[model samples]
Target: ARVMVAMEAELQQHPAQGVLVVGDVNSTLAAAVSAKKLHLPLIHVEAGLRSGDRNMPEEINRLATDAITDLFFVTEPSGQEALLREGHPASRIHFVGNVMIDNLFHQIGRLRADPAAGGRGAALRAGLGDRPYGVVTLHRPSNVDHPEQLAGLVGTLRTLASDLPLVFPVHPRTRSNLSRFGIDLGPNIHTTTPLSYMEFLCLWKDAEIILTDSGGLQEESSAVGVRCVTLRDSTERPVTITDGTNILAGTNPARILDVARTALAQPASGKRPLLWDGRAAERILDVIVDSPLFQPV
Candidate 1:
């Protein structure tokens, strides 16, 4: 509510031709509401994604943001289909590719140019070296909010860590829960505080596989063709599963292990989804410039 009020005040002071909001975060929904109320054109980027689980707050945000969106810039074909199914006109929806992937590619290019650019990346390599390892990141409320559920997932990581090093960049919530639940990550699992984007990219890009409950990680890992085992039951970004290296293992320990083993055995395919070619921002600009909202009345 605070964000909405502040956004409303800012827009009133100096209005934009259109208000753009990205992703399913709470701030996105707040800004979207403020734009609609002010009668400004609402543009939604990374729009039309649905995990079909109202239980997730992000799903509600996505639904609400798209409901009032005048222009929809989608990342995948699934987004196009989803919006059409929701009765949004086809002309209003434009498939512009994933801007997150654009940034991922950009950062990877920077890393390649200067390997020692980020001291954290160098520090990570000095410790872990070239040995094949796995990355673990868990923070979703579904995974970390409960003791039993968190224990089961951590135990799975513990078993995997026994064979090879698993770099666990623990989320603050997950770390707190670990202390609260009396769960041990085991000695084999290398636990660290959360990492910066470049530090994390350097760490996970070279890993043999990644175990995560993060939606962005699913897509990022897939972009590099690194096998990713998503901890959640469902994902809003289904393109990663169909075209990238992501496997949905949910919270089931047995299934996670099975998928992890399988993923480890297979080589990174390096396959990327269509239009993830680091030019999504350009396409978004093209759409915005051509749209009616941008035209002089």
Candidate 2:
């Protein structure tokens, strides 16, 4: 909180001509506040997302950001509608698609070009050792704050590990919860530090199933044609659910295990086509460059 306040003060002192704040909804609120004070136009790249739970802080940030942002760069039609329903003028919302898709497409090409690709693949093969593996990541505070809920999630993973290995790239928050709740990670569960974006993309591409509470990973998993089991009770990205690429398993141990087993058994074969064509940044740039509001002083 102190850091955010300090940074905001600094930005206020020397405001840039155009400022774009991307990633995590928390910064959205800060951007909104900053825009109001600095008189700089704020562009929310992946805006209009709402988990519908104000207790989550992210929902609060999303609402606050959308309320004050001059332009909304949405990922899907639903996101656009969300902004509209919030009383934002239609002219302000532009469906520029998801930037994560752009990152994935770019990184996939990089991985192919790198000579270490073969070595990484080899390491993954050795680590997995012919065993089908599912990737799991849980970071939402609602799920991890409660000991019973956290234990249930871990139990579900343990049950799924009976058939296939569950690779968990443990987020620091989740690790802390595990230690706090005294939840044990079994032999079949492999926990590692948070992976780089490229490494995570490779893992998502290769995983038999992805069980996660992350919105970005859900989208990426679907883009790569991988089956995903969402651990949340509900999602802001309903496109994944409607497209049949992801299933909401909530936090129930039995349901998580059951849905994960089902997803692994019948993985989606054809890519269901991503919401964006990996040109969101370019589109946003075009909009900003062409808009009358973007004139240079």
Candidate 3:
């Protein structure tokens, strides 16, 4: 693959002591494979996550990348347990918490400091000032690629919109589906093109609730203490549900509506998962320095 070749060339020319890859994307797997083939130590961040759905491409990437990873940096206890069960050495697996949450906190601090930052966020706020709103995002192939399933979700969103204003940052795939399937989001649902990270963070941070099929949003919402309803049936990040304010409603229309309604009615309340205190990157650095892979020969 292109990523593998590029990684190989980069390593051959610059010869790093260790190669680090993050998350379960295709590039992560490619880089992991390249590192192993070149006899370099492969460090994987956000490793050992499993959604148990082999059908998901990301699940496959996680499994394959962890199989050859030398050091595993995990976000949650479940990740550590999953790696242990898969026969990875305990010493190599470090529970360094979620770096994404750290970035979330950083961005939020920036927004708070300025209050006038993020153009789109300010515009959105001006439009919906002093009113409670909800956020919706759907992009998973399991939900959007299939017409029948997508229609069901749209219908349910329409119903929810009648009661609550829903701001949907529609993914390109979802937008195409809307046009192709002739699905109307109804007047109550406001659709916008995808937003910048700060714009999105500003929009969702104070929302009453978020409806999403995204893996990262689930964790971000939980970190911000905002109620979130996951549109997917299974999530790799179970800590969000157990310790944070995330509810799994799957794709079923009735369940999603019921859960979203209940979540909206309740005040957001949840403890941050252990070590999600914006120090995960620091912990990762400490581990790397202490690790044998980085020790002087």
Candidate 4:
């Protein structure tokens, strides 16, 4: 109710002809619902992604958002196909590549240009220091929302930590759950507060491998040619698994351990997905500019 009320007030003051919501989240869903209630055209960026798991709330958000979206700016071929399969008009769906990659490319350039900007490089080097190590990040509700699952995941990581040093920037929710569940975050795994993007990227770029439940990490790892193990049964961004260096491990500790070991032992290789070039933001703007909704009135 609070989200709806705030959206209503914002739109009333601004009087937009339509709303364009990006990615799947509570905000995205709220905007989608508000736009439809206002009888305004809705545009959805990164539309038609599905993890095929009905239990995940993000999957439901994607479904609801895509249903009401007047225009679909997809990020990949599979997204276009997903929209087509669901009976959406192909004319309304435009494959505009990945806008997130544009920001990633920019930040990487900034990090490379000013190595001293964040002190990220030195911090990373000081922690791992010429030794190969793995990075771990887990924040998905499915992974950490429950007591048993969170404890199991943490315990598994603790075991893996003995094999190779694992760095984890703990999410607040995970930390609370660790305390609530009486799970000891063992010393073998290094834990820190959540890091800024540059600092996190610094750690990620130098890691031997990454084990995560994050959608963005999958794409980033694939983009930068790093080995990644996804801790989910399915991924909405299938391109990461199909073309990139991502391997799905679900929540099974044994499976995760097996994949991590194999990943560390093997020589690394990965292929970039189509149209992930740094100009994706430009393409998105081009579509929005040419759209009938935004034309001179």
Candidate 5:
């Protein structure tokens, strides 16, 4: 609501410029409505991705935002197909590839140069100290809101605790849910606050495996050649599964345990590069500049 009001104010103040809205669904929708009202072109990044579950607010956001966007910058060909299925004009959709790929490439050189990156990897190994460990991150409301779901995930983690350390960077919302439900963190499960992007990337790089409910992390884990077990039933990015880098475990304890065990049993192998060549932003800019419809504000 606050975002809507702010966008309305911006539209009222200056209504002639093109506006691009980035981020989650709510912000995208708010920007779209404002852009339409102001007769401005609206661009949506990370467009046309869906988890196929109406229970998730993000699904609604993706659909609603795409409805009003003038330019849809998608990460994958699948996203373009999804937009076409929804009746989005073919000319409006552009597969600019994943911006996160651009981000990762931009940072790789720096990460390699930084002593902290190596030190952090060493520190993670020292902390685990010869014990196998898997990184876990949970933030979805579906899992955290329901006691049964939360308990199921925790139970799976507990079972694996003897063989592997589960490093969980608990989202504050999930933490609150944990307290509300009285879900106890087992001794082998190390819970901590969210890490910075660099810190988290380093951890992901070093982990034997990753179990997550985050779409971005799922992609990142695959990009770094780590095996990922997604806690969600479905994913917007299905390429990870096709590439054999990730498996959807849902919230089923048995499924989660089985998948995690399988992932641990296998030798670590890098996944095929599925994102982009790290020039997505440049490509997007080139396309925009070349397009006849493009007019810089």
Candidate 6:
């Protein structure tokens, strides 16, 4: 593959004892394959995750990475069980919490320290003016791939927006989907380009409710005590749904609307899950230091 060749050349010049790949994307799979071919230790972060749906590219990426990685850094206990069930050696698995949450803590501080830099959040406030509002973010193709689905989903959100101002910070793919599907964001729905992380967190934290198809947002919402309605039927991050404040509504427009309504009526009474205390990066470093692969040549 093109990626493997590129990685091989890079490694040849600057040899590494180990290579670590984060998140389940094409790059992670490519790095894991290259590391295995080179006989170098591979560390996989946010590993041992599955949605039980092999049809999803991410599910396949996670499976392949776990199959070959020398060690795994996981976010939750379910990851442990998933790896164990797949016959992975228990000793190689390490639960170091959600590293993403560490970034969340850092960005929250940055947003608080400099409210002027609240990029998208500041602009949102200028127009919406702190009134009770909701947030909607959609990107996954399962929810918006087809014209019918995209139209239905947007129509539902438009209906919800009539009651409360809904800010949709659109992803590039979803923006294309809107045009391809010939759908319009109605008067009540406000759409903007993608927001910076700090701006997004600012918008999300104070939201009355959030309707999204994002796995990370589920965790982020739970950490900030925000109610979330996941537009997906299932999520790899089940901890957010079990201990945190996430509810899966599938892709059905009616069901999504219903879930959003329920979320708005209820309080964000979700508690932060275990090990989401903003020390994940520290724990990750400690694990890396202890690994024999990290020993000096």
Please give each candidate's TM-score. 0.98, 0.91, 0.98, 0.94, 0.91, 0.96
Q: Name the regions of candidate 1 deviating beyond 4 angstroms.
A: none
The candidate scoring highest on lDDT is 3
Q: Is candidate 4 or candidate 5 better by lDDT?
A: 4
User: Cα lDDT of all candidates, in order?
Assistant: 0.90, 0.78, 0.92, 0.86, 0.80, 0.88
Per-residue accuracy of model 5 over 32-101 as CA lDDT, tens digit each: 8878877777888888888899888888888888888888888877889999999989988898767886
Q: 4 or 6: which has the higher TM-score?
A: 6
Model 4 C-alpha lDDT per residue in residues 1-297, reported as the tens digit of each score: 678789988998899978989999889999899989988899998899988998988899999999889999988888999999999998889998888888778888987898765465448657677788889998888899898888888878888889889888889988888888898878878888898888888778768899999988998888878999999999999998888889988898888888888888897677888888878879878888888877877
What digit string (tens of lDDT, one per residue) describes model 6 on residues 4-121?
A: 8899889888999889899998888998898889899999989988888888889899999999988889999999999999898888899989989988988889888998778877
User: Stretches of candidate 2 above 4 Å error?
Assistant: 1-14, 115-125, 269-275
* Model 4 accuracy (lDDT, Cα): 0.86
lDDT of 6: 0.88
Q: Write one digit per residue (lDDT tens) for candidate 3, span 149-262.
A: 999999999999998898999999999999999998899998889999988888888888899999999899888799999999899999999999998898998889988888
Write down the RMSD of all candidates, one decimal each: 1.1, 2.4, 0.9, 1.7, 2.5, 1.4
Specify the poorest-scoring 10-residue window by lDDT in model 6: 121-130
Q: Which of candidates 2 and 6 is the stronger one according to TM-score?
A: 6
Candidate 2 lDDT over residue span 106-210, tens digit each = 888888888365344435546887777888888988888899989888888888887888888889988998998899989999887887776667666777888
Q: Which scores better on lDDT, 3 or 5?
A: 3
Clashes of 6: 0
Error of 4 at 124 (Å): 3.8
Q: Which residue pairs of candidate 3 clash?
A: none
Error of 2 at 67 (Å): 0.7
